[model samples]
Target: MISTSPRATSVAGEPDAMSAREVLDLARSQQAAEDAAAARKLEAAARWADLHPPQSRHHAASFTLDGIEHEEAIAGDGCPTVAEFCIAELGTVLGISTTAAKRLIGHALELRHRLPRLWAAVHAGCVPAWRARLVAEATIHATPALTPASVAWIDAQVTPFAAKVGPAQLDRLVAEAIARQHPAEPVDPDDPHPACPDGRHVTIDADQVGFGGTTSVAAQLDLADALDLDHALQTGAAELKALGSTESLGARRAMALGHLARRQLALDLASATRLAADTDLAGQPTSLPAARALEFHLHFSAGLAGGLEIDHLGRMDEGQRLMVLDLVKSWCGDSHTKITVKPVIDLNTELTAPGYQPTGRQREQIALRDRTCVFPWCSQPARRCDLDHTVPFDHHAACDDPAQPGATTTSNLGALCRRHHRLKTHGRWQVSQPASGVFRWTSPHGHTYRRDSTGTTRVDSDPDPPAPPNRSSRAA
Candidate 1:
C-alpha cells in the first residue's frame, strides 16, 4: 500500500497517486540535487573571493551555527598510534602505495595532536575551517616532530611575539635553534680506499664550529701522535698530562682529532669536497666549504697508532707520509697541483669522510643493474635511488639464507629511496628475495604482486575484467 503523506510528495501534485518506492526514489534524487547545488555554490563563492578584492561586501552574508557548546573526548588518549597503524596497514595490506599512506598518516597525526584549539578558533567565527588548519600548523602543530612539551614551549614563546612578528617567523627561529642544538652526524666513506695496496692517505685540516660547538683539527691530531700503539697504552707516566687543559677542547674534538689521524694513515683518503661545497649556507661560507676545502687540524686519530699529543708535522710515520703523497698525486694527477685552497677544519667533528670503497667495476655493475628505483610505484631514475642491501647485514645472521653469500653480489642488492628504506626497517613491510632479480611484494593484507627488472607487469595469463574488492580475485 502506498501512502499519500506530504513527505512522499514530489511537488504540489494536482492529484496523482504514487507508490512508496517511487516517491522515496524521487525524494532522494531531489536531496542529491540540493547537495550538488550547495557544493557548487560553495565552490563558486571561493572562486569569486579569489578574483575580487575582499572588502565590507565579502562579509555581507554571514551566518553561524549558534546554539550550545558541545564536548568531545580529547584526542591523544585513544591510540595516537592509530595513524601509524593505519599507514602500516594501508601500505602493507591494502597494497596502497607507501608514499601515499605515509602522507595520509602524517596529516592525520598532525591534526590529532592539536584538534582542540584548532576547532575552537573556527567556532568563534574568527577564521574559516581551512584557516583553522593553517593556524593549527602555524601555532599549535608547527613541526612534524613536535612533542607536547615542544608545543607548550612554542605557545609560551609565540604569545609574546605574535603581535609584533608572526608565527611563520617564529617557526623559522625555532627550526634554526633546533638545528643549531642538534646537528646531524656525518657518515659515509671513512676510507674509500681501505685496501688501496699503496700506503697513501689524505690529511684534511681545518676548524669547524656550530651554534656553540667547535672542532680544532690541528690540536686533536697532536694528541694521537703521543700514544703507544703496540699495547694500546697512553705512556704518560710523567704528569699524565690530559689532552686539553682548556675548556674549549671537548670529547667530540678529541674524537675528531683521533679519526683524522686514522684517516691520514689509511691506504686511501680524500676530503669531502663535494659534500662541503654542496651545503653552502649564505654569509657563512667558511662554515661549510667556499673558502678552503677543509682546515687541517693539529689533532686527530692515527688508525692503529696512538693519538697525536702535540703539533709535529715533520715526524709523520711512513704510512702518514704515503697518505700525504697520495693526496698530492690525486690533487696533481698531471704535474703541478692545480688546487689553490688548502683543507681546513676548525672543529674536527665537523669533518666528513669520503664515500664507500667502491671498485670501478663494482660501480659500473651497480649502474647497469639499477637503472632506476626498484619500488613498485616509484619512477625515480637510478641517480635518485640509493643502492641498498636487499637483505640487510644488520638483520640476525641466523635469518640470512646460506644459499646466497657474497656481500657485493648483485642478487643481494636493490635500489630504494631514503623514505622506502625507513618503511622497510620501521614500518610493517617485508621484501622477499626468493629468486635472483625477481622481486615479490606482498601487501600487509596478503595481496601478492611481482615486478621484474624492466619494471613491467609480469602478471599471469588471465583474460577477464578487473576483479571486485576481494582476496579471491586477481587484478586485471
Candidate 2:
C-alpha cells in the first residue's frame, strides 16, 4: 500500500527487498532531516530579529498598532508563526508597537526584494534589524515621496542586486532609510545646534538628500546626542563624498542618508503641525492652522487718544469696522511712543482684512507675486497662500491718514501660507526682508533668521510620474 500510494520512492527495479528494521531507520532519518531544516529556519529568524531592533522608542510607539500584539500573547502554548513571534519580540523586548513590529516582519518575508547577502548578514547578527529591515523595504516598494533623481540613483545602485528584487522596491527601502537618518533644518549653520522655542532642538539639514529633493530636516535632540549625530552624519558624508560615487561605501552611505532624510521629514511634518482639538466655534466651524498661530501687535504711540473702546461699542451692529476705527483712534495720539493693537484669528495663517475685504488692487499684486509661503522650512506655492499685509491696513497707525483711506500698497502686501501666517500673527513673530525676495523673521525674544529664495526654481521634467493615482504630484 505504501509503495502504491506514491510516498514510497525507489529507483525502478531497485531496493524491492528490504527488512522492517531498515524501513524504520529510513523513516527516522527523513524525519530527522525535516527537523534539521526547521531548526535552521528558527536560527535564521532569531539572528534576524536580534540584529534589527526597530527605530527610536517614540517612532515605534507612534507608528505601531497594539491589537496585533494582544493576539500573539494569547497564543502562548502553541508556537506562533515566524512573523507573529517577530512582532511579539519587538513589542516585548524593544517595547515597539505591534504595528511597526508587524511591518518589520512583513519586510522579512519578502526575501526576493532584498539582497540575499544583506538578509543573511542580518540573520547572522552582523547588521542591526532596523537597518536590515530598511534594506529589506528598499528592495520592495517604490514610494512616491522620493524624488525622481533619487529614485534613479537608487535604481542604478540596486540594479546589480536586481536578481533579488526589482528596481521599484529597492528604491523604496533606500528612500525610507534616507528619510529617517537626519533632522529637518540643517543644524543651524552658526550654532551647529539650534532648538525651537518649545525646547526641541532642530536637527534637519538642507544638504542631506532624501527620496524627494533636498529639504531641511528638523528634530529635537539631546544636546550631547545631537552632537554625536552631527559628527556621524558630517564625517560619514565627507568620507563617502571623498570616496566618490563609484565606490561601494560611498554609494551605500549616500543611499542610506537619502532614506534617512525622507523618513525624518515624514516624522516631523506630522508632529510639528499638530493643532488644537476645538473645531466648531459658535455656529460656524473653525479650523486652526496646522501649525502654531501667529499674533500681530499693533503698537500705538499712546492709548487711543479719543477712540471708542470695545466695551463702548457693545450695542453697535457694525462690530468689525467699529473695532478697526476704535483701534485707529487709540494709536493716533501724538505721543512719541507707538501705541499697538492686534487682531487675531485661528483658521487663516495670514492676517487678512477683517472680512476678506482687501484694500484696492492689493489682491491683484498678491496674485501676480503668488508669493510662495515665506516660512523658512516650507515652500508651498503662493496660490495656496493667503495675502497678508506687512502693516495691517486697517490700523490707523499703519495709515498715512486714518480718515483719508485704509493703508494699501504693493510693498506692504506679502503672501504667507496658512501656517506661517498663523505663526507670524499669533506667535509674536516679526519678519524683515532686507532684499527683494529674501525675508528674515525675528522671534519674539529677538532672535533673527532669514529664508532665502535661492532654490525656488521651477522644474521642467516629465520623469516617471509619482506612483499612485495623483497626477499633479507626479508633475510637481
Candidate 3:
C-alpha cells in the first residue's frame, strides 16, 4: 500500500479540489490578469513625458526614496527636461542602470512621437508591449529619415497586422515597407570610387598563443579586399583538396589563407628589382607587364539586367553591377581570357534523379538559389552546408511511395548547416518545403517559421501569409 499525506487525503475528500482542466483555466486567468497589469505599467511609462514638465534653473525638485534624497537638476538653462528627468527618476525607481533607463526613456519618446497606434494598442492590452517595441524599433532603424507623415504611414500599415504576427514577421514587414518607400538610387557609370575616403587597410592584432608555438592573429579589412582574399583562400583550399588533405573544409581554408599570405611575402622579398624602379634606375626600368588574370562570379536575375534593381544579396546596386560587368569585359579583352555564362534553372517538372543523393548539377542550382544556409537565423554560405531533404528519404521509400518516389529534386531539398541538420534530425524541430525554395519550420512549442530567398519570418498560422508588399514597387 502507498503511504499518503494528510494533505493528499484532504484534497481527495474535498469536492472543490481542482481538476487538470480547472487548474489550467485558473493559471490562464492569472496570466491574463498579469498581462493586463504589465500593459498598464507600460502605458504609464509611455505617458511619463506628458506627466512631468521640464523645470527651470530656479525651480528644482527633491525626492526621498528608501532613505536617500535625490535632486533633479535642469537640463537646459539650469533646468531638467522631461526626458532627462524621466531617465534619472526611472533608473532610481526601477533599480536599473542609467544606460538601460535612458534606453527606456528613448523607447517611450519614440512611442509617443512615432507610434501612436502601437502605443494605443499596448495601452488597451491588445498588443504585447515587447511586440509594440519591436515594431517601433524596426521602423526607426529601417527609415532613418523618418518624418511625421512617414511615421504615420508606417503606423497605418503595421498596426493592423502587428498584433497577429510574431516579432520576426513584423520586422520583415517593416523592412519591406521601408524598401518600397525608399528605393535605392540608380547605379551611376561615372561613380567608380570607394565609399570611404580612406582606401583599404589591413591591420593584424596579437591574440592568444596556442600550443606547439602557434600564434593567433586577428585582422580587419575592407569588404572588397576581404572578399578578394577569401576567394584566393578558396582557390588555395581547392588545390589542397586535390592534393588529398584530410582536414575539414573550414580548417583547410584557414590553413590555405595563411599559406597564401606567406607565399606573397616570400615573392615580394625575393624580387631582384628595387621596390621603386625609378629610384634605382635612371628612369622606370620598363612598363610593368599586364596584371594576372582574376576570375569571379556574378549572379542576378534576367529581369534585373536592364532594371535598376538590387541584387539578391541587397548589397550590389545596378550601377555596381554595370561597373562589374564593364570591368570584367575590359579585363577579358586585355588578358584574352574566355568568359563562360551558365544559366541556373529551377527544375520543378524534371525528375532526373531517383536516389536520395542530388546530382551535381542539381546541387549547383540549389546552391545558387539558396545563396546561404536555409536554417532560420543562420547565415552560413550554401557552399558550406549539406543539402537536406525536407522529408526523411528512407521513410518515404519504406511507405511504397511510387507515385512521387520522394525523388531528390529541387523542391524537396534545402541546404542546412551541420548544426541545424542535426537539430532537425534528432531534436524536436520539424521542417517542410511547401514550395520551391520556400521552407516552413515547426518548433517543439508549435510556433512556425517561414524562410525564402529574402529572409526568415515567424508566423502565427498562415502557411503563406499574404506575401509581404512587393519590394519592387513604391507604397507597398
Candidate 4:
C-alpha cells in the first residue's frame, strides 16, 4: 500500500490491478491527457504573451546594453512582443525556467502569426501540440529566420505526418524549407547553374565526448591536402619511433594529430635532429615549456571487474581505463598533471554545517552520493545542481538551538536542479529525503515518485488489487 502520510501524494490505483485491455485503454487515455496538457500549456503561454505586450512608455527592459538588440527581436512582425520580466512570472507558475518560458512563448507566437495552419491544427486537436511546437521552435529559432512562405510550406508538409514524425525527419523538412527561402537577389531566369559539388568538411564529434576521455574526429579533405596530412603524420610517427617511442601506430598517429595541433611536428631532418636533442634517452621530453596541467576526476574502484568512472568521460572497464590513462600520460607526464588523492568520503555518515550553505567538502560528498539531481526525470549532474533542504529550513530555530540541527544533514538534503528547486520553492511540488541520496517527490497533480541513484519510479497505491489477470478467469 502507498503511504497516506503528509509528504506522499494520494494516487489512485495500480496498473497491475487492470486487465490487459483496461491497461491498453488506460495508455490511450493518458496519451490524450498528455496531448491536452501540452495544448493548454501553449495556450496559457500565448495568453500571457497577449497580456504582456511591449509598452510604448516602458524603459530599458534588458539587463545589459548588449542584450537590447536580442530583447527587441524576441518576437516577429504581427506576433505581440511580450514584456521581458513577465516571462519569469509565467515560468514560476509553470514549474519551468524563464529561458524555457521564453521559448514556449516564442513558439506559440510563431504558430499564431507565422504558421497559422499549424496553430489551427493544434487547437483543432488534429495534431499533437508538442509536435506542432517542435516545428514552431525550429522556425522561430533557426540560424537565419525562415520566410513566411517557407514556414507555410513547412506547416503544410508536416501537418499530415505530425502524429508520427521524429526530430530528424522534421529537421530535414525544415532544412529544405530554409534552403528554398533564398537571399535577396533579382531573379535571372537564364542563369546557368552548375551541378558541381564539393562536400569537403572536417567534423569533431563534440556532442558525444567518448567514455575514454577522447573525441572522435572525421574529415573529408581535398586529395592533395589529405596526402600532405598523411605524409606529415607518417614523418612524425617515424621520428617518434626513431626517438625510441613505443606507442602503437594508431596511438602514435593520434598523438601526431595533437602534435600537429600544437605545431610541434618536425618538418625536416634538421627539425627532427632538434626534436631528438629536446628528448631524453627515455623518449621523454627534458622540459616542456608550454606543457599544460590537466585535472582528471577519477572515482576509484575496488576491483577490475567493475567499471571505473571518470568525470566528463563516462565509465570504462579495466583495460580500457588503463589504455586511456596511458594516452593521457603520454600527452602530459605525471609531473605536468596534478592528481590529488584525497581521503574517501564516508557516504553513510550524515555530515552537517551551520547556516544555509553547505561546506565545500559537504557539497562534494553530496555530488558523489547522488551523482544527479534527485527530481523525477531530471538527470542534471549533482555538481551543477543545488543541494536543497527537503523540509523548509527554519533559520530562527536552526541558529538558536545548535542541539536541534534540523535540515542541514545529508539525510535531509538532496540535489535539485535550478528548475526543480524553484518548483519546490514557488510551485506546489513537495519533496522528502528519507535517506542520503534517496528522494521522494510529490507532483502538483498528486503523483508520487521515488528518485534514488538507480532513477525514479512511481509509487502505486496498490501492488496486488483483488483482480485476476484476465476477465475470463475472474468470470470463471
Best by lDDT: 4
Task: TM-score for candidate 3, please give it.
Answer: 0.38
> Candidate 2, which ten residues in sequence have the lowest lDDT sum?
467-476
Backbone N/Cα/C clashes per model: 66, 68, 5, 0
Candidate 2, superposed: residue stretches over 4 Å from native = 1-356, 393-406, 434-438, 443-447, 452-476
Please give each candidate's TM-score: 0.30, 0.24, 0.38, 0.55
Worst 10 residues of 4 by lDDT: 467-476
State each model's C-alpha RMSD to the native.
Answer: 26.5, 29.4, 26.4, 13.0
The lDDT for every candidate, in the order shown, is 0.39, 0.43, 0.59, 0.66
Instruction: Point out where model 1 deviates above 4 Å.
Output: 1-100, 116-360, 367-372, 378-386, 391-407, 422-428, 433-438, 451-476
Candidate ranking (lDDT, best to worst): 4, 3, 2, 1
TM-score computed on alpha carbons, candidate 2: 0.24
lDDT of 2 at 203: 68
Which candidate ranks first by TM-score, i.e. highest?
4
**Candidate 1 structure quality by residue, lDDT tens digits, 1-476:** 44456544335655656666876999988866664553343333223223322123245456433221112111222213332223433443323465544443333333335344433333343324343333334432333344555444543443343334455765565555444434455645786744422323333332123212232332222235444331132222111225432333344344334434443311122343424444445733242122213222112233334854422222111111212333333434422223454232221111111222234343334433444456555544444556666665533333335533324345556666765655565545567555444466554555455544455342334322232221111101
Clashing pairs in 4: none
Tens digit per residue, CA lDDT, model 4, 120-207: 8888877888888778877776656666776777778777777666878877776666666644455566868643447899998643
Candidate 3 lDDT for residue 81: 39
lDDT of 3 at 195: 47
